[model samples]
Target: MTSHQPPLWRRAVAELLGTGLLVSIVVGSGIAAQQLSPNDVGLQLLQNSTATVLGLTVLILMLGPVSGAHLNPVISLVDWALGRRSGTGLTLPDLGTYVVAQTVGAIGGSVLANAMFEVGTSISVKDRATTGHLLGEVVATAGLVLLIFALAATKRGVLAAPAVGAYIGAAYWFTSSTSFANPAVTVGRIFSDTFAGIAPVSVPAFVVAQLLGAAVGLGLLLILFPSAARNTGDIVLPHSAEKTSA
Candidate 1:
């Protein structure tokens, strides 16, 4: 850990707060979209995607310095996996804490969004179960991972905030499942029945697909950037004080 880096507890808090705000943005915008564009599915999607893109960019930029803003469990895990051999990135215990914080934060965010919309906490009933949807999730998650790590690998980490947001916005339109790429977000969406919600029954398959996609993404990262050219410090925050040789 870098001398300037916050202690583990503070970093964990940042992760929790960041992930919570991210999910709140997703669920809140989805609810607002449904209300503003009642009958137009396309318009609703556009609204949701726009909000998500802008919100995500801001969130990453704001929180990256604190916790690397790994709002997604998969990103944290992937960072650990790639950097473990070099003892540069997240430790094994950090991985567990980050994932737990992200998951809990996401669930809290969903509930908070629902409360804001005057919708009491409720389980999602929207059943999104199909091979095509599952495949889309896999593709979406894979692309997301590829984009983030690719930026890190190529030393373009500064562009991650905007690039990641833009890719997710595009994936929302292109993917059949609307790109629920983060496992924590997927679990969070189960708490709402609005446009962004996913039924409990469908959560398992989506998670499995996301994990598989992450594996594929890791493989691609290894293939495309096999050397230890990446700076581990740039994995999460572009201008962070930490510098880990790779």
Candidate 2:
């Protein structure tokens, strides 16, 4: 089945809405998990991860045809880096637009979640700036990017939604920082002083770690799929879809 790619304006709106809803799911579910399982931290995590997995899967499947469902800046940058020369990937202007939309949408999502939960919008006080947490972020993001591109390179793009969701669900449990793999989501989490929130001071280190992880993931992609042809556009677009770079 051929997929119709929307115009840049519509695509950007999809990214904005997709990213906003994704963060709302993350922060909203986290808050619910906390409230539902006040005593058991493990149960809270389980609940949060489950909701995130399901939510992310739905979001990707729903928006992949539109904007490539690039809810993360790193994904957009990587797509641009690998495909810019091919003239099939994202252009410089597209990158800037996607990043801005994702970031602003993320912050809006956080506020929306806070309002929903009757939690006043406030900066997170929970500091997650330890070295171990930073390392965990690096690992989490690297694995995420690797999983995404690997699927694309191997012609397993059809599985991108479920695989990406499953990896993130697992990463939440295994990673020390609970794997805020997306930079936009990380920024959004700062607006909620609830279960999913991260302190403002911790944001910079986490973003740096994620960027480093993206670099690492790109290197690994080169090594692992040396002869694999690069895919154009976003990390995961709907199968057989054609999209013009913004």
Output the number of the TM-score-best candidate. Answer: 1
Candidate 2 lDDT at 98 equals 88
120-178, model 2: which lDDT tens digit per residue? 99999999989999999999999988888888788777788999899999999899989
Model 1 has an lDDT value of 0.87
lDDT of each: 0.87, 0.87
Candidate 1 lDDT over 1-246, as tens digits, reads: 334565678788888888898899999999999999899999999999999999999989988888888899988888888887676778788889999999999999999999999988899999996899999988998998888888887787888899989999999999999999999999999999989999999999999999999989888878887853345556666535655554
* Per-candidate TM-score against the hidden true structure: 0.94, 0.93
Model 1 off-target regions past 4 Å?
228-230, 239-246
Candidate 1 positional error at 192, Å = 0.6
How many backbone clashes are present in model 1?
Answer: 0
Native-to-model Cα distance after best TM-score fit, residue 74 in candidate 1, in Å: 0.6
For every model in order, what is the number of clashing pairs? 0, 0
